[model samples]
Target: MILVLEKASAWWDYAWLTFKNPSSSFVEITGYYIDRYASVGAFLRIAPNSSGTLGVQTHLLQKGQQYSVYVTIKGTQALEGPFKVQLPAAESEGT
Candidate 1:
């Protein structure tokens, strides 16, 4: 079963990180970080050839530019990235 957090809305300041299990076997999530804050779910499980999404907390007041998000897989190497996504500008009230 998949669980989606209601707080994951368009107006959220946090960055959304996507993770995938490359191996044919299932992979366990050891740890992940969004900037400085740790992920809410630790020791999470992912199916083989499956993917999971998590919201990485970010604060614009602290950073003026960009930040990085990384994940550690159990019995495997850690993947790091300064993942970035740009949201489309909201339309005008009248438009």
Candidate 2:
């Protein structure tokens, strides 16, 4: 499986990054950030040519900015899951 975190800014960033899987099972991914709004990208698994993730990232989010994530299984197939994203909370008065 391939995982992608995108930061959608008009500025420069890594267009694509590839990962090689040394195992043969499903992978658990966490804390992924897609930071851009318009940029398009995907995670590609070459061995079985199965499962990928595609999304856009953005730097700014408004209240109710609407964030959604979907996964693609076997390239052409899509599966939806329980994905949620929240704005980073402000620092408290005390450390």
Candidate 3:
């Protein structure tokens, strides 16, 4: 199993997280962000040689603050990340 968190794009309140299951068995993923103590139920069923994406919401996130993101495979101790993500300051209205 492979997990990756894509660089956050235009969305100020969420980030795109991708998971890949390269083995010949199906896998499920559950995730959470440490800073907010919020759990994101990705619970994806990724088949062999397949991948999926989940949108991790940052609604509780603050600009310039770093958050630790983690994902774990269901029914196993396999875990990934403390993936650090920092949100850029929101653009001000009316320059």
Against the reference, the lDDT scores of all candidates come to: 0.51, 0.36, 0.65
Which should have the higher lDDT, number 1 or number 3? Answer: 3
Candidate 3 residue pairs in backbone clash: none
- Model 3, span 14-72: residue lDDT tens: 75666666677777776554554866676667777777776777766776566777777
Prediction 1 TM-score vs. true:
0.53
lDDT of 2 by residue, 1-81 (tens): 243333321212111223233446554332234433342344434343234332334335443343544434442343433
Cα lDDT of candidate 2 equals 0.36
Model 1: lowest-lDDT 10 consecutive positions: 1-10
Q: What ranges in model 2 sit over 4 Å off?
A: 1-23, 26-39, 44-56, 63-66, 89-95
Best by TM-score: 3
Model 1 CA deviation exceeding 4 Å by range: 1-11, 34-41, 60-64, 77-95
TM-score against native, each model: 0.53, 0.32, 0.69
lDDT tens per residue, model 1, 1-90 = 122222222223555655665657776766666566655455667787777766555544243344555566667655544455432233
Off by over 4 Å in 3: 1-10, 92-95
